[model samples]
Target: MRTRLMEAGLHDGATWRISPTPFLLTSADLSAIQSLGQHLLRFTHALNRLYYESVRGAQPTWVADYLDQGKPPDLIAYARMNRFRTALPGVIRPDLILTEDGFMISELDSVPGGIGLTGCMGQAYTDLGWPIIGGRDGMVAGFARMIRSLHESREGAHSPVASAEQRVPAPLPNPPQPSAARLAIVVSEESKDYRSEMLWLAARLREAGLPAQTVSPDDVIFTEEALFLAGSTPLTALYRFFELFDLKNIPKSELIMYAVKKGHLALTPPMKPWLEEKMAFALVHHPALEPFWTHELGADTFELLHRLMPKTWILDPRPVPPHAVIPGLTVDGHSVSDWKVLASLGQKGRRFVIKPSGFSELAWGSRGVSVGHDLPQTEWAAALEAALASFHQVPRILQEFRKGRHVAVSYHDPVTDEIVPMPGRVRLSPYYFIAGEVGTEGASAGPPSAKSVELAGILATVCPLDKKLIHGMTEAVMAPCTLA
Candidate 1:
């Protein structure tokens, strides 16, 4: 497995301890994880609506105020535009930490990495006769279906007979074959480390009968009406592999948005910056929004999300009244009224995490995360101070930290050339793909519909037991998940 991964060229110069065997999950666990996709999808749809309603006067204005804290006005307005109102992320990956009872969702990534890497691992494990959770080519197939759906829907929307509401589009006289549609996974300079994996993904898509390519932002060519590659290679759709925070650094970003706005280009994980914010999880827990979420997400999804999402508090510096305490947050059996009170908690009482909410370069890859128990008292205090200071520009969240249960995993030690058992904590990343269903000629009139969310694959990053963050590192064991 190590040799196969080394030869796969999907690592992009980073290295990890390769596991000799796949991570084992019980049948019940697999079913739960697979069932999570639709709930997450419905949650995402509700969150989008929440944001939009807040922008108008339907929902609380404070909700919009919280989401738009650090965002530029122009970008915020662009995200609220009607042309892209129905857009939702095509890919969703939640970082789930396995605990004693079950698992807790630590974070959700709309523009996540590891698709191609997971695909490679899936193929490698399948070749060894392991029954991988998703099929050997599941990732590739799922991505292809998503892009094809995007292209078909966009093509119909831009047709001469497209409706203003975009509920449905007129049938084309000659529809292009799904394989003939070209796709560009435009990687930004900030995301160059994962470019190789996306390139590998494009190759797999090509093999699955979809014309796809991975290119840098500089390689994109934008005319007044459409976007293309350097060689005038027209594209049918674009998978934005970059984050909105890095838009200023991205070349021709405005042009790309222009094309999308002009209905000349189709993009996934759409340009909704609000959807990329980690604060959505915090909002889901807000008591004032409970009725709103309950109405939009239904009782079951609302309850499930509440259970899965840990207690998260946005580190707002503004003071509450002396009588009022931060809802759902307490330390030492006391209702804390000020954020600074957290700075005084002892190590045992400080089992919390501070991380950037989103729209910042430090938000991803565990860059700006501070674990309360892992640091000294002084450092924890400083982390709290910094989070408060940056609340206006780059908001941060304080979340209850749940420790992962210890487990044993075997990895190949290149120096010893033997498999060795290593005890570690696991972080499971399950990739879910959302594809829309094209309406038939006589279908009822309404908004476009999507099929059930597909669980493409699950990648497990088992870090050494001592490590606080379970991410891709030299000491961590990276592998696919399979049935126990």
Candidate 2:
């Protein structure tokens, strides 16, 4: 490796001078990751179905309203369109904290970061002849496959729905691929953290003779014929590199979705905000909805998910009856009637995490999280009060905190130019890439179609165990994971 390249490290824009060598996972670890992908794929399908069913009075009215709140009406309706009824995000990355027992998935992201970072690092390491997990081509191929599949799904023939009320997929004719359709990744200003990595990814794809590049939403120009970047490049498929919450800030962002709705463009993470929330995990643990989840996703899948997901409860600040207690929570050694009482929990009782529901800037990164045990009593109380206060607008959830076990890994010490050993907590974010036909034959089955969700790549962030919040290149060692 060149000295300049080593000095630059993984920075396209964000600088990460971590090890050039990747972290190695055990084969058993790999198997567990693959199993997680299969289960989550089925879980998301069932969750989506459950959401719509709840909207139709099969469940509760608050379900749909909670997910749809603060979303643009047109986009909500567009998301619910029969054309997108079966649509799932092609890329799924879950934040898995490695505890002594195993892994506890803390968060799931549809529009996740680390894709381009994972791609660039994996490709670089693969070029060095190392056996990287998910292979060197995993991220790139996964993304390209997603684009291609989304393009085909949108262009294919549609089956007429029995009624507007019924949201079943109506498959239409399969449109042939365009001879010269182009691909570009459009990033919004809010997601500049990964812009450079995406550009590097595009350059890599271009070297392999693919039409790929990264463009900002501001650079996109729409015409009666198609949506073009810089007025000359017609985009057949677009991978949205921005979050749904910040789309309004992008110049002419509305036009891109308009283009998608009019058949001039194909976009994904598919303008679906519901899938982007962290609160979906809490819904999976809802006892009242367990039957619906089991019916939509078979009992075995539900059981797996139940065991996988930690105990979580959506925090609603509505006052409880004097005789009633909040499920799974207590204060002062008794059932509590008020939400404010949660703020006074002592250090021993603060073994939980407070997270936002989503649709806000706070939803991304570590900004929206409050690690109870890590904070002082006053600070913890204050954070809990703030979260409770935001119940109506920005909902929050409390999840049982799972402590990550310390693991030893070596990192590149740029100062000494040496590889040194360090013990840190691991956050395993495995990128499960969905390809081929994503339409699951039976979401209620035990596992999803294994071929649909493939193990694209794994990103391991090993941060100092002392650090409560893990993210970015700060003191953390970021690397592509391998089962070598």
Candidate 3:
């Protein structure tokens, strides 16, 4: 089978390279894999519910999208297979396929490319001196484990419907390892922090016993000879064009995936337009300048979710105002006047929290103004002007105030959906002003809560445009072009 795939140009050195290890499995691996598959299914289901909630007003007609489409039978079969207490008799093939709607279990070979993380997992396991598993096989096992952990954790508890079971076979034998090959790591001088992170990941890969090298992006001059030797054009060549603009610090790598700062130079005018064409990349953090990047986070996450999921949804920030700004309310059959906006706040008698629309951190002296206390009439008017000015700088939203303790939930795929909650923190001073309180301690504690993650997951499933916008934003940031 592997030989046939190679002859068909499906293996490495042909067109799309198939990893050497295919379906490495043991009887013990089945339970873990099943659990992960189940979790992914549940998460997808939950996301679908959230999506429905998000687009209810905008596209009320498409409300029954999930139920109307119906579940793919392959997914049903795979779901059943996950619940089998004992290893099934037949050769179990876990074919989890991700689609726009959700994941369906398809033929094993039908999965898409860019799943190198599975190989990384295998390498990690091997480096740990565990029994060597084939790369492809390790991916299958690892994916199974990830799904199982996610399922058991119930992170998708918000899902409206429970996941149904399907029968799947037990693990097969270990496949052969592929011949050793040199993988390149592209780096640029400009992004030292990113370059350093890549180098660190490479070192970690090396510790996992994989041979890896870090090379400067500019240094990787692409020529016909080099391309011929590698049996193809080096992907790193794409980034070299940016050097014309003295963007020498940009890093490029065929083997290492790039991570760009969300709203920084990576997505500046010169680079964004060019990078959008390529689908080989994935973005890490959502870009600040482009709020839509958050939608694309689901693409990778959906790959993790689609084993047994019916659908998924994501939130659209457009309709909902930011939590900072207070929504205007109707009073006595008429809308409140602007003059009364602060007057209304004064009457509340509590500290009023002001936030710029879509912006998180409160501007200095603009954090929380205690009505009638910290804000006297003179000061209140001035602060109100400042808040309104800053709000107008972009889009602004306001929230009355959240005096409750802040906590965050982190979603982890551990063959169960694990939601870990931690305390949230706010910085009282800037790092330069108070290093300990503002810099390190504050930064670590500002992540969103578990409820936020759940909310985000739901929103992603509902809004299709959100996903497209996010992908566009991510590509723009990660694959910025250099000026000629």
Say which candidate scores most in lDDT: 1
Ranking by lDDT: 1, 2, 3
- Cα lDDT tens digits, model 2, 1-484, are 3343333344532255466678888787788888888788887777777777877888877778778766878778877775566667777889988888778888888888888778877877888888888787777766665555555444442224334223222332222222243677887788886777778777755654457778888788888778886746678777788877786687887787777767676666677778777778777876677778888778988887787778877777777887776665655568656767767778988888898878889987888899999999999888888987887778888888888888878777766879888888888899986654433211111124533676789999988878887776567888888876
Specify the highest-TM-score model's number: 1
Query: Which regions of candidate 3 are displaced past 4 Å?
Result: 1-198, 209-340, 343-393, 399-484
Candidate 2: count of backbone clashes, pairs at least 3 residues apart or interchain: 8
Deviation in Å, model 2, residue 313 alpha carbon: 1.9
Per-residue lDDT tens digits of candidate 1, residues 112-159? 999999999999999999988888888888787777767766666657
Worst 10 residues of 2 by lDDT: 438-447
The residue-by-residue lDDT of candidate 3 on 1-484, one tens digit each, is 2243233232322222222222222343333343443333223223333333323543233332222222233322321221211111011123332233333421111111122333333344344444433332343332222222222222122134534221111121223122122234444554332344344434443444333444566454444323211343332111121211233234333211121111100111112111111000111111221222225224544445332322111111223333432123333445433433444445345244333322122211233322333456667566555545543232222323322222122222223444332222111100000000000100101111111111000001011121211111211111100011
**What do the candidate models score in CA lDDT, each in turn?**
0.83, 0.73, 0.26
lDDT of 3 at 241: 19
Number of clashes found in candidate 1: 0
Which 10 consecutive positions of candidate 3 have the poorest summed lDDT?
Answer: 429-438
What TM-score quantifies how close candidate 3 is to the native fold?
Answer: 0.27
